[model samples]
Every structure is written in structure tokens, then in C-alpha cells.
Target: MGTHYEGDLRVALLDAAVLALGETGVDGLSLRGVARRIGVSHAAPAHHFGDKVGLLTAVAARGFELFTEHLAEALSGGEADPVAQLPLLTRAYSEFAENYPEHFDLMFRPASVRVEDPEYMRTSGIAFEALRAHLEECQRRGWRGEADSAALTSAAWALAHGIAVLRAHGSLARHYSDPTLDAVEDIAVSLLF
Candidate 1:
């Protein structure tokens, strides 16, 4: 029930912040708690991350990077049909949220971290580009949607992100008999395409 973090304290601190966020939510998260989780002195996190917002911002940045990586991998999978790619992308989005719920929570909650922070700006762009690129590909493939790529991508992200949030917080549990997220994502994306 605990991580035995080795090598880098910064990594340990990040992991600890994520773990704390998942267990306690944003209000309960603090630098001291993260230090306690990692068996470090209270000053350790303060020195490493400066403050609570700073620590959570770092977590958000990492979340965006991880999310983008998974999304890119899903896009690169052997699904050439643009319509077919929606399900893959949905599944990948849910997977990232499930695998890193703490980071996911921090990434979406603007108050926890500065939404305009440079790290967040860059990393979120990377994540958003995956969806935008897919929408462009769909357009090029002769999909007759009139909306621009930005609009399409925004809608796609909203649906995918909504599913991930629901699944992460168990909101989907009441509706779906199957706890596995893939079926839910497939069904949801099926409605869109």
C-alpha cells in the first residue's frame, strides 16, 4: 500500500503527490502530507516544489505528458479508418485516467494548478494535438462534417474526457454492468461516429 521510491526524490515527491491526490482529493493534499508519504522531511517537498500549487502543477504537467504518449500510441495503432480510430482514442483516454487518476484529477482542476503555466501549456498542447490530428485525418478521408477541425477536436475531447472522468470516479458503475471501460467507450464513441 506504499511506494518504495528509489533514486530521485523529485520523482518520489511527484509520485507521493499523485498518491495523496487520489486518496484525499485536492483539498486534503499538502506538501507535508506528500513528504510524510515519501518518508522525507517536511522541508523536502517545499524545497523541491516550492509550495502546494507548484507541486500539483508539476503533477499536472506529468499527467499531460503521459496522456499524450498514450494517445499518440493509440493513434499509431493499425486502425486506418478515421471513424474506427475514435474508439481506440476513447479507450486510451480512459486508460490514462484510470492508470493515473491523481494526475488526471489535477490536470482537469484549474484551481489546483495554474492553467496557464508554461509546462501545462506545452504538455496540454501535445495531448490536444493527438485529437486534433485525428480530426484532420477524418476530414481528409472525406467525412462530410461541416465543423472545422478545432470544433471537431474539441467535441471529441469533451466526450472522451467526460467518459474518463465518469469512469475514474465510478460514476459509470451504476449504468454499466461491465466494469471494463473499453465496452463503455466503444458504445459511447459508436454514438458519435
Candidate 2:
């Protein structure tokens, strides 16, 4: 098996941070604990991340990068059907949150990330722009009843983000249960259109 001790410690540390986030929330996340999880000395992560916030910012940045990629994929396949794309786009958002719970949590919580950081801002903007573009297309095609594309975009994002947050925290399970994440995702995606 590939070892966590090898290759890139920076990547390994971020992965460990995500795992730790599942065990404990943002306040409980620690650089030292991440290092120990990866079989490295506690001080090792400091070389790349200086501190916990720095590390989390990196993780959030990665999350946005992945989120943007998934969003782009939704827009691909030579389909001009904006309405049809909504489910794919939102599904991608939901999957990113569910798949990378730690990064997803930090991605939304400003306290854990340095929003002023250029890389973080740019990465997040990519994802935002992708969503905006789809909403614009929907508006242009009159697929949505309203001409206010911005509101449409915000509403769609709210639905996806709410589902992501609720699922990540297992809030949905506490109230009503969906047999699986996929089932919940399908229900959430259907809500978009």
C-alpha cells in the first residue's frame, strides 16, 4: 500500500485534516493532530502551513478547485440545455461536500479560511462563475420564469449548499432519513427544477 509518510506531506496533511474534521469540528482541528495522523512529527506541517488556519485555507482552496471542475463537467457534453444542467451542477456541489466533508465545511465557514487570500478567492470565484453562467443561460432561454438570473442562481446555490451542510453534519438523518446519499442527492437535485 502507498504510505502516508511518502510523496507529499502537504497533501497528506490536508487529507488527515479532513479526516480529523469528521472526528471533530473546525475548532477542534489541529496541525499537530494532522501530523500525528500521518505518522510525521507534529512540527512537520508547520513547514508548509505555518498554522491551522493556513492549513485549512489550503484545504478550502482545494475544495473550491474541485468544485469548479465538477461544475464545468456539468456544463460539458455538448448540451445547450440549461434547465437540464441544473441537476448535474447541483449534484456535483452535493457530491463535493459529501465526499470531502472537511473541505466542504471549511469552504463555507469564513472563520476557518483566509478569504482575503488571492488563491482562495480565485478558486472560489471559479465555482461561483460556473453557477452564474448556468443561471444566465437559463434566464436567456426563458427556461426559468423570472428574468432575474441572480436570484435564481442564489436560490439554486442555497438549495445545494443547504443540502451539503445538512448532510455533512448528518442533520437530515436526525430528522428524516434517506436510505443513502445518492437517494438524498436525487431528491435534492429534483428540487432544483
Candidate 3:
């Protein structure tokens, strides 16, 4: 029998999974690895999560929740103008990536793990909804162009995703010392406008 902790093992396993994923890519993540990291037997994770994919799905869901919360907080803060808000969002994203590098990797890696699990889809949808709401606010303030709102939103997401990916890969910092999310937002906004 697997040892039980005082709190929820599922949550603990998910946390361990994120750490393992951050340290190693998705391909390197294993239930046994997470279990060992958490000081449990190899089969402990299987008790909490059926398989490796189950653990990954849980981690992905948690990642989306964290991402949504950070983005929402950024939008709520009035420290900057709309033009500046984009960069703040980008910065928040980059900060999240840096802080939770493992979650960041799993969150964006294409086809590395299945996200079809209901919990994963639901959490992912929440993140998308939060982004859409932010985009709607931008539209309300006349920050967008004649482009369709959905298209504009998609473009903004793509721009942010691209920059975040570059930043994560160390290409942006290595290639440009002055690289900042503001610089990226400026280029995106200028192109869109």
C-alpha cells in the first residue's frame, strides 16, 4: 500500500510532477520520477494518478490556473496604459516561465503530452477566456484595429507566445541585450496598427 500524507497526495504529486517537468522535459517525466522526488514509492504516483499522462494532465491544469491568475492580476493593476499593459502581460508570462520553467515547458510543448483530459481542457479554456476578456478590454479602449476581434486576439496571442518561446529558448537575450517585452509589444502594436 502507498503511504498517505496528511494533505492530498494528488496535489503533492502534481507539484512534484511540475518540478520534475521543469528540470527535465516532458519526455523525461515519469510517475516513478515524481514519486521518488516526493519521497514515495514508485507506485505511489500511480495511486494518485493512473499513469504518466494523468500526472501530466494534472500539471497542465494547474499551470493554466496559475497563468490565468497572473494574467488577471496584471490586467487588474492600473500601473500602466493599454499599450504598456501588453508588455506587462508579456513580462508576467516570462516571469511565470522563469519561475515555473517546467510548467511553462509542458504548457506550450506541442504534442509532447495529451491535453484531452477534461480537467486539462477546462483549465486551458479558463486561460483562453481570461485572454479573450483582456482583448475585449483592449477593443473597448480602441486599442485594436479594423481586424476582426477574434483575429486580433489570435494575433496578439501568437505574438506573445512567439516572444515567450524565444525568451525561454534564450535566443532573445543572447541576440539582443536590450530585448524586453515592451520592445516586442511595440513591434507587434506597430505592425497591427
Each candidate's lDDT (Cα)? 0.82, 0.77, 0.74
Whole-structure CA lDDT of model 3: 0.74
Q: Give the higher-TM-score candidate: 2 or 3.
A: 3
Q: For model 2, how big is the CA root-mean-square deviation?
A: 3.9
Q: Which candidate, 1 or 3, has the higher TM-score?
A: 1
Give one digit per residue, the lDDT tens place, for model 3 in 109-181: 5475577778778888888877777777777787764558778777777877777788878788887675665
What's the TM-score of each model vs. the native? 0.87, 0.79, 0.86
Model 2 TM-score is: 0.79
Best-fitting candidate, scored by lDDT: 1
> What does candidate 1's lDDT look like per residue over 73-180, in tens digits?
877868779777778888888888888878888888897798888988899888888778878887887764677889888888888888888777787877877657
lDDT minimum window of 10 residues, candidate 3: 184-193
Q: Which number leads on TM-score?
A: 1
> What lDDT tens digits, residue by residue, belong to model 2 across residues 53-149?
8888988999899788766875687556877667666666777776777777788889778999888999988878778887887777777766577
